[model samples]
Target: GESVGLHLPTLSVQEGDNSIINCAYSNSASDYFIWYKQESGKGPQFIIDIRSNMDKRQGQRVTVLLNKTVKHLSLQIAATQPGDSAVYFCAAEGNGGADGLTFGKGTHLIIQP
Candidate 1:
């Protein structure tokens, strides 16, 4: 019934530029939040995560901001580069993993020289 897909299929930027990845979730009752980065054929790597009780979380060279009021989520990347070019996805734990996560379509991030 619910599915997660990418918002922007592709994104391009310079080696020293910044990137912003966006994701939209269907389930509003989710509690846990996680941001993953998939590079090519590799598995998704955990970037950052936050709970419903908190609104923002930060990590090394990454920051995640959650807005439960609108059910919208966004990931901000500082100093984007070729290595940062990958598919970014946001997943939410529906009802504490009861219903699972409904991932977004997905967004392809591309880096330029």
Candidate 2:
């Protein structure tokens, strides 16, 4: 099942490692999916995005994979740095318009440097 707004965020990790987070979505009509990273006191920053028409998307050190068949998604961070520590969230564009995004409960990525 996909997540709504009632979820909390938390992350913990070591200084220089890699982390991978997961997300589950339920909307088949969603055409766009995005992954964002939010630090201690900041808003979400776009990490990567994949269109429903595509299966995967990649960014600087981030990768987003979309499995439309099972309605599942995942994000992989390579060579995670201390600064890479943050809460990660997966969002999907609603059926109607691209303006509104449905966010999932984020996973906290903690870095112990």
Question: What tens digits encode model 1's per-residue C-alpha lDDT throughout 1-113?
Answer: 44454567777878787787877666677778888888888998888998989888888888888888877788988988778888888887865577776666567888888
Query: What is each predicted model's overall lDDT from 0 to 1?
Result: 0.79, 0.78
* Residue pairs clashing, model 1: 4-103, 4-104, 4-105, 5-104, 5-105, 5-106, 6-105, 6-106, 11-110
Per model, state how many residue pairs clash: 9, 6
Best candidate, lDDT-wise? 1
RMSD of 1: 1.6
Q: List the residue pairs that clash in candidate 2.
A: 10-108, 11-108, 11-109, 11-110, 12-110, 13-110
Off by over 4 Å in 2: 1-11
What does candidate 2's lDDT look like per residue over 9-112, in tens digits?
65565666667777777777788888888887899998899998988888888888888898888888888887787788889886556458989878888877
TM-score of each: 0.88, 0.84
- Model 1, global lDDT: 0.79
